[model samples]
Target: MHLAFLRDYHEALVIALARTRPTIERGTVAEITSLTPQAVSKVLTRLLDDGVIATAGVRRAALGKPAAVYRLVPESRWAIGAHVTRRALRLVLTDLAGTVHASATTALPADFTPDDLLGRLDSGVTAMIREHRLDDDGPRPLIGVGIGMVGPLDQATGTVRDAHRLRHWHDIPLAELAGQRLGRPVLVDKDVTAAVTAEAWRRDAGFRDAALIMVESGVGAGLWLNGAAHRGTHTNAGEFGHTVIQLDGPACACGRRGCLEAVHDRAADPAAAAAILGVGVVNLLQTLDLGHIVLAGADLLRHGEIYRQVVEDAVRTQVPRADWLTAEVTLTGLGTDVIAAGAAIQVLNLRYGLPDPVGLRLP
Candidate 1:
């Protein structure tokens, strides 16, 4: 069993490397992943048999014999990612390479219930599958569905413990419920965390410590720390909006006073809203010492330049010795579809992405 697990791990590691590079040879894979040549050969054989990868050609160097080169077959797997916001349900179809091939969005009913969401999800997924010609007959079948939702949820149990402002979500078993309804496996995670995962997957390894600050119907921060998603002990880590920024200030929907979301919502103008969000970003930077700050969400993207400038100014002016502790602040490259795309990538990661090497060290 241990050997089998390690074999799977090595296979995932090779696939991950192949996704980044144009072609991979056995020696290169072994060197980068610290896997033995024999192990790489075994993993490569299995991947080739499974059609996950294909031999590109032969590489011959001046010093050694020709070596077979392999590359990932990105279309070898597919997943559906759903972003369930307060206002809409956005879905995307992503391949193994984390590329969003097709996407669709539909408005949700005001204060939608669990039943309402499931109903729409069932129909939406069917339409997406049919429209994209994503049938089970393909070389890469649709594996599962991943949901990026409003949080205060338990990722471990796949339950929504209590989504802050959503009335119909309390200890809701979303993963199980959606799985049963759609007849496919399901994975659930906080929206911000999923958004950050998408950013990390797309940005290469340099985006180790960062925050995806989303400002849509509400505010939240998705944390990517030490090259992985950082969900707190209860998986409720990205509740940035509820953080008390003003004592005895306006009452927030979460039953908190002077929350960052509340203050930003009550701001008189877009500039004021951006400034409020900027202060929150500074607080996150102080706590995490992040390398990147990605601003996203439907509401924020509407005024993208403003939010980007304000947050960049805050990081430059508010943080001490800004030159010494520079943090890159920019808008999300994926825009409003980030969370949904990330959710899809989360599904792919669960199945094929390599585990964090840091977590694999012996105690």
Candidate 2:
């Protein structure tokens, strides 16, 4: 079982490498992964047999025999992801390569309940499967559905434990319920965490230690630390909005006085709101020392330039040493599609991507 697990991890590692590059060769894969050539050869053979990768001719080096090349068969797997906001359910279809192929949105009733969400989720996944011709028995099959939702939730149990501002969501076993309703496997995670996963997926390894600051109906930060999603001990790491920036500020939806979100929302104009958000961002920088700060969410994107500039300025000017503590601030590349697309990618990652390198310490 241990050897089998190792083999699977190696395959996943190779697949992850293939996803980042256009093509991969045996020697290069072995070198990059620190695996023996024989092991890499065996893994390559298995991947070829499984149709996860395909040979792409051979590379001829001047000193040695030609090395076989392989590339990821991205269309070999598909996943559907849904972003459940307070007012809407946004769904997207993504391939194994994390590309969004199609998207659909349906507005929910004001302060929607779990059942209302499940109904829309059921219909949305079904419609996407039908429209995209995602057959379960076909060569390229739909893997599962992923949900990026509002938080104060437990990702480990896939349950929503009273999402902030949403009255109907307390101890809702969303993944299980959605899986039962849709007749497919489901994975649920906080929206900000999922959004950061999308950014990390697209940006590759260099995106280590970053924060995705979301300013949608409320505020939150999705943490990507050491190249993976950091959900904290209880899986409720991102409550950036509730952090008190002022001791005597306005009362927030979270029932806190002087919270970042409340102050930002209460600001007179977009510029003032952005400046408030910037201060919160600087505070985050002081704590996390993130290399990248991605501004996302509908509200922020509406005034993207202002938010981007204010945050950038704050990072450059506020963090002690301007020259040494440099950080890049920008808007999300995926735009509104980020969270949903990320959710879909999470499903793909669960199946085809690299497994977490934890708990197993090999000699």
Candidate 3:
């Protein structure tokens, strides 16, 4: 059983080591993965046989002996990720190790239907796969399709509950529909939640616990806790942008008045949402006590400094117990590509049979 656990961790380690520096020696992999030298060699042999890795070259190290380096082969299977936002659909294709290979974005027509979107997404993936010459039907290179969409999704039914922008999109079967068209299994999730899942396994800061708040065309958040992403009951727990802030403020497109989205039109312009988002975000800071709220998406990053200042001020004012809620509300390092990168991460995770982020129900 212990070896079983190490077995999974070992595959992930080899992929990680091969990616970090493009090439790695056996001794270096041992240090990074914390596995013994002999154990690392055993794993390397298995990986090479699987065609996931290949030997780069041998280098003389000052410590003990010379070591052979390993690199990721260019042709190990791939996973496809799709992001359907208000006006456009973004696509990302990546390898088993979650490294992106090709990406494309297409504008979505205003009078589009669920069927229309599915067709476009399917064709996009097909064209991209063929263009990249990555199809061989060897072992199912395409793991699955992951979608990052605007939400209030019913996980059980895989339906889109009322969306502000996608008024025509309601209770539509996304995963099954897309799956039928693409000939693969599909995972549909909120865009922000996907972002949270993508960012949690950061090799840099290594923040295992954090919250990702995105003030975009809509506002939402993805929470990461205990090395897992947290989704609440109904899978829409992080719907903060829609929470009512003003009962009599402005009529939201969703038919609500003074809601976080009503006053904050971050989608219209990110600078606008900063004020309204700050009001409630401060309250959440003191309540969750979890540090590191990530401000991502197109809108928030547009007026990043303003959003940062407003949230920071609110934290200082509301969380009187601390100077700044004891957390850092920041931006995502991935920029616009996050949606695709995150989706790719989801694809790899599902392939490896890893646990879904905490709080997300497995429907």
Highest-scoring model, lDDT:
2
Ranking by TM-score: 2, 1, 3
Error of 2 at 175 (Å): 1.3
Name the Cα RMSD for model 1. Answer: 3.1
lDDT winner, 1 or 3: 1
Model 2 C-alpha lDDT per residue in residues 36-132, reported as the tens digit of each score? 9999999999999888899999888898798888998888888899999999999999888888889999999999999999999998888888888
Q: Can you write out model 3's per-residue Cα lDDT over 48-102, one digit (the tens) per residue? A: 8878788888888688677787887745767787878888899988676555678
Residue-level lDDT of model 1, residues 1-363, one tens digit each, is: 998778778887888788878899999888988889998999999999988899999988898799999999988888899999887899999888888899999899988899999999999999998887776657558877889999888887789888766889998999989989998778899899889988887776688899999998899999888888888877788899999999989999888799999999999988899999999999998898999999999999999999999989999999998898899999998988899999999888877876753231110
Candidate 2: minimum summed lDDT over ten consecutive residues — where? 354-363
Those runs of model 3 whose alpha carbons end farther than 4 Å from true positions after fitting are 1-6, 13-39, 56-63, 67-77, 96-101, 136-140, 201-205, 253-256, 266-272, 309-318, 321-325, 352-354, 357-363
Evaluate residue 294 in candidate 1 and report its C-alpha lDDT on the 0 to 100 scale: 95
Alpha-carbon RMSD to native, per candidate: 3.1, 2.9, 3.8
RMSD of 3: 3.8
Q: How well does candidate 3 score on lDDT at residue 138? A: 70
Better of 2 and 3 by lDDT: 2
lDDT (C-alpha, whole model) for all candidates: 0.88, 0.88, 0.73
Candidate 1 residue-pair clash tally = 0
Candidate number of the best TM-score: 2
Candidate 2 wrong stretches, greater than 4 Å: 357-363
